[model samples]
Target: MMLMAAVLQAAVVQPAPGMLVERRLAEAIPLAVGDTVRVRALAGSAQPRPFVVAGVFEREADPNRIARNDYEVRLHLPDLEALLPTHDRVDRFAIVLAPGARADPAARWIESVAFGTRAYGSAALAEETSATFRVVSRFHDAIGIVTILASAIFLLCVMVIRVDERKRDMGTLRLIGVSRGTVFRAVVLEAIGIAVVGSVAGAGLGVVVTRIVNAHYARVYDTTLRFALVTPRIVLIAALLGLALGTIAGVLAAWRLVRVAPQKLGER
Candidate 1:
């Protein structure tokens, strides 16, 4: 799946010499527009021939986006047909929709026939491209959840031990007029402190583990897998989970202390 994502990201197309329509002339030839050059027509001619460089045109003006242009050359369609013997097969066709165009009928028809097209809108393409990354992201979230769950269980056990060891101390405090609320607050604060420390350490460990996996797998497979793509939202979510888990563990551990007999602890 990772390999598929990489390939899809890398896939690019360029125009051939014989093709009449090309998106960008800048990409087709090394020289600027109006620069004359010799080229053999792949479709119309039997041999290499000379041709003039027509004026260049821009296809799309979005500087940040990939440019898909329509190159106007001096060759006719018949010339293209004559150059290639296998003219029976058309490799690709470009179509543009009118403003507010709808292809629902065509789409329904295609679906009824159990077929699909590669043509998609920019938004659709973006969604499809991001889907792979989303899957990988969810996998990372699963790892975080597992870490938090394990930490919660361990902290609960530790709280249980501390409660047992400090029972006498707590009893004395209670006798001296330390309210149950104060004792509860102290225990909760301590648990939160432990959770915060453990969570920070766990985050650092996660980064190291991710780096090691990415480096080892990339070296073995000769592929790039980026593991440092952390976002603020993801980090925030992880932190909240850790905090909530910690609170739950603290509550469980404090339950027994809160339920102690007032008389037995000399609170009367």
Candidate 2:
């Protein structure tokens, strides 16, 4: 959540008043923290002011991830005296609201002001701020849904086959004075074993894949892109989901098999 908030803050880039904003350029001078830099004015002013550098950032400028041009640079913000020399123009501001303050009310208040007639909020602000978080959340959702559906289909098939294969065995057990409850429990245990194995293997594969991708990307770009690494919480949820799905399939299969009479089993 901290990472999400930090990324959202970066995504919402609104320059302060009279600051000249420049995109990352090719063969640009690299910047570090506390490095003072200067930016050419958009108005083509003769002199450039030494602006104290706050920070530097690197990110893919592409909206779509497939085609990407990676760029890195520092943003140079001009001071007040620097603003006095150039044609004064303040385009936008990135406002950080206090925790207790409602963004909607603040936006409305800004709109009520005479100068705030052009103020816009809500959808536009969200688009600018929450792009990365929304994309990543959707991606994770799709992966999780697919994993559950695939597991369900696989478990269903396994349960159906196991029931069919053990029909004669189940019939014999019933004739030998075993209750239907015993048969149900045995079937549930078998399903539990299958679910445990599958969940463990799948979790291991996910971890390996994440590590490989992370290493590859870092080697190529030297940039840290946060991956959705599996945690204990995620693993626990996956296990619970898998066990539930498997038990349901197994019980349904076992119930249908138990309904068959011993005589019917002999005919089969």
Candidate 3:
């Protein structure tokens, strides 16, 4: 009862007129605590109102805000009203429900009370807003598939050339009584080694590129949001995929060499 009473009393009371400025806005305007700033609403012809800066805050690092990057000022309801010509009117409201409260019911109740207003759950809002990202993700997936296909084809070609170059040596080994299985294993092992080395080099390059990209973004945006990330899991997946492709390519190339007569392989 005491806690509820205190909360009610606090709700009934209004704090002194002051606004919190966004970090970007504060830095751009060079605002500090206790500094006075003149602000005017863009919607109305009201003259600029003097306001004391209570605090400077960093905006939440969110995907939605990254595109807009708008400056913001948070002030009391009365102070906001005084700055603009409008009175007792609000464009939007954010409601926080208690634990175990259903969003649909709360949203319905809010819409019932507030005519001409639409309320959406977090999931619905995300689904509606994330269409662009979904499209971009699909495009990236398509590009990745094409890139993998190209890389596999290129690897096959490289293996074929390498095997062809060593044909005479392989023929000599076979003449010296080296078994077909031994030669096949040698080629496969070479492919596996190439895949391992390539995967490591690629991972290193990816990490370095990600760092460069993130640094550029940080310098430009003054935010810590990273544009690219190279995690261990991703690196491991690439290595495994490389190994699989390399093994397959090696098998095909080795088969071409082994099926021919040793005498034919010795020819230029």
TM-score of each: 0.52, 0.63, 0.86
What does candidate 1 score on TM?
A: 0.52
Give per-residue CA lDDT, model 3, range 1-268, as digits (tens). Answer: 9999999999997544688998888899788999987888888799887788999988777766677767888988878888777797888777888999888888888889867989988788889999988998899899989988888898889889999999999999999999999999899888878878888898899999999999998888777687788998999899998999889988988898898888889898
**What is the lDDT for 263 in model 2?**
58
Error of 3 at 8 (Å): 30
Q: What are the runs in model 1 whose C-alpha is more than 4 Å off?
A: 1-118, 122-148, 221-224, 262-268
lDDT of each: 0.64, 0.69, 0.87
Residue pairs with colliding backbones in model 3 are none
lDDT-superior candidate, 1 or 3: 3
User: Candidate 2 at 164: error in angstroms?
Assistant: 2.6
In candidate 3, position 182 carries an lDDT of 95
In terms of lDDT, which candidate is strongest? 3
Global fold similarity of model 3 (TM-score): 0.86
Put down candidate 2 lDDT per residue, 1-268, tens digits, no spaces. 9999999999897643322222343225554445556654455455665655555444543334422644433343445535445544556656777778887778778678656355556568668767777988899799979978887988988988988888888888889899988988898888888988888998899789889987886656444554447789988998898889978888888778778886576555
lDDT of 1: 0.64
